[model samples]
Target: MITVTIYTHQDDITLDQLKADLDSLQSTVEHQVVTIDIDTDETLRKEMHGSTPLIKVGPYTLRPPFNRQDLEVTLRSAQDRVKYYQDDAEYIKRVERGRRVSGADRFSYWFSKQYMLVLNALVLLFVGLPFLAPVMMKQGLTGPARVIYAVYSPLCHQLSFRSWFLFGEQAYYPRELAGIEGVISYEELTQAETIDLNAARRFVGNEMVGYKVAFCQRDIAIYGGIFLFGVIFALTGRKIPGLKWYLWVLFGLVPIGIDGSSQLPSLAKSFFPSWMIIRESTPLLRSVTGLLFGITTAWFMYPMIEETMLETRKILGQKMEVLKQTQKANR
Candidate 1:
């Protein structure tokens, strides 16, 4: 059956008159009428606000000041069009496809609306677990702590020298080449070979030196920055405009790139000539670059995702409304 949907305010007197008109044509036309109150239904308010007493018959729509003759003509046209296409296999398939709003569609709708919460929670989990590993180690929970460390090992370099330490004399231990004065360097304390990458990664530190966090200092800063921006975005009701792409590249990508790339030459000093400049970045420089990259990247990305999700929500919302009308008509 063709569906006739009426959109209007609850107080609009024209709604009764429009319904009476539909009823008058009952002898000649068979259609289900679904009335929606724009004031109470937020989706309809957004879509059809100020355009009420609106009438929809199949694909045709009529606005205010329309008379009974206009309604009849539109309804008859809708009926004829339905009859013309009712027997076509393609039309039937299209109608069936449109009517089938599956569980996936419902899930997509829900996710689109609640994605920020999920993202924030994920960032929190990603950033929080690394800190928890060290705390667990300090508390003698070696089994679970090792598990966290192993899980994160693939994601980060996790070099003890480059990672933060908790429950010890210092929060971090950088290589002597970092040129951080006063504090004991990683080589001075551990006596490990500076060139031994495997040893650095394997060393989780002792009680005297403090256990290392599952993530490197830079990684912790990056994810922490992402989480911080996520909170700020939520607090501001996500209305903040996205950072411009060029600005993001300059502030987010360039510093991190330079800090990371410049450090690589020091790592592969064997490959470069003796004349080439080599330097190790301090914990402060690593953290600053990581934080800038994380915050600005999120600032650039989240707003774009929000825009896409919003459009998805609107499309799915309209589809949901149509599905509800279809179900009502079937009942």
Candidate 2:
């Protein structure tokens, strides 16, 4: 006896055709073959819950769009196992030969892995750089650097309170720019104001230069974390112990989220100075990571290029072999 099965959730025209096909194959095969609708049998349906249209044929289940020849082959092989089919050994050998994976075929496997590195770099440049540039520059450049502000306007609110301003006329923050003093000329400075400034200079603490771009701590960590690791991965081919390993990257992301989220809600802020340090100094850190990203990307590219060269060499070698054979025959 030979059995094959297919499982599906429901029955319809497709199921009807499948059943009809199995009935037609009865004449060609020496065993009792029949199609059982799993949907019709409550017990079968429950037994295969969530997995439908179960095709059960002897020891193996028929998976779907059943190829008659493949089924016949399977059935024959099974029959041989029971001493029912005479040519079982030949059949087994044929199946084994078909399953063999050759050395040349491994090219695609290596190529797929390498391409992932390139994909990570592309995401960093297109999605990351534009979003992060303003945050990075807000503390370094002032006014007319409004260009960076304008560029980012579509993506974010660029709210005054959330933004950071840099040097010139008292690190002009956007909130101050919106107020009356925004357009004031230097000539309007009062002697009293200058006296007060000179007096207050000794007390001036380090000011917050850039408006906190609306992105809180976690946002920086996730985007920046992925960006950071991606860079190192690409540069070093994702081999670094501290950065490339998944656990360390996750560890690094924790502070990014903890610092950003905890402080944003006015909750307990435990991971501060470290958070601030990471946020402000990301460019340098990512620079190291970026080198890694580049390495990873190059690593991917190197193999693609090497394989193309290898393939060319293989073809050339084959041609040389053929030419040498011809020359020997001529001699």
Candidate 3:
């Protein structure tokens, strides 16, 4: 059967005439008509502005100012094409190929409809890795433990001073510069001449200092917050509205920006004259900022991603349905 797509806006004057032309062609062509309102979608309006009330008769398209005569001609051509292909030897192969494509489309639509399930699984893996690395090391699984640490090294600093330890006395040991009086500092525990600041980033700790995870405290907070948000989203059925850009900037961008950027100027103070004064950040502030960025980023983007996934499902699902009906009719 021929498919007719009518593109129209609410204010389009020629839509009535176009509808009349289509209705007049019903006896002339075996076709299905689908009307799409371009008002709600600016992209559709821009695409069809010169061709308002654009009509599709099978593979043929007719712009505005066209009459029923044009549609009849187009539909006749479409019918002939179908008839020619129906008796062709290549038709079976073509149908089989089309069926395969339709199955792929259906799978694609199903994936889009349940994109959050994939997203949640990814988030779980991401957050779960840090804990796993520590567990592996504690159980004397040094091979996998080293591999995990090596893999995560490029992504994070993994500084022992700023990282949490799984099987340890204290969860965290901040740097001396971090200035927390109560908790043990990195310097007091390790007076080894073999250790330096750069090496600290690679240090995974031993039995005395406790085995550090593959990720640092801030990184842990970041992934943890993202995973936590993913869980909440799943629990809430992902009905949350998209986070506004302004709110994203205020919450997601600002706190992390301030906490991260503020430390830079302090570190660069030596590059300037003596008059330049700068400040340093503590581990607590880093974790807090990282956590805020992670949670807000997920909150801001997840719902917007859902909107895109929904649109994808709509398009692919429609195609899949059409393909299914076509295959059944052909059989």
- Which candidate comes out best when scored by lDDT? 1
Q: State TM-scores per candidate.
A: 0.82, 0.28, 0.71
Model 3, 306: alpha-carbon shift in Å?
2.0
lDDT digits (tens) for residues 104-183 of candidate 1: 98999999888889999999999899899889988899999999989999999998878899988898888888999988
Candidate 1, after superposition: displacement of residue 192 in Å?
A: 3.6
**Candidate maximizing TM-score:** 1
- Model 2 C-alpha lDDT per residue in residues 1-331, reported as the tens digit of each score: 3434345556444666665666676666555433434465444466566554445554566555456676666666666655653457876574444334345534544443465466566756544544454444545553433454455556543333322223324332211212334432212322232223222211111233323333322233334545555555557643443324354334443443443343232212243544442222222232344344434434444445444544444433333333344345447
Q: Flag regions of model 3 displaced more than 4 Å.
A: 4-27, 32-100, 192-195, 265-269, 272-280, 329-331
Candidate 3: clashing pairs of residues: none
Span of 10 residues, lowest total lDDT, candidate 3 = 314-323
Candidate 1 structure lDDT: 0.86
TM-score-better candidate, 2 vs 3 = 3
Report, for every candidate in turn, its global Cα lDDT versus the true structure. 0.86, 0.43, 0.75
Prediction 2 TM-score vs. true: 0.28
Give Cα distance to truth, residue 281, candidate 2, Å. 15
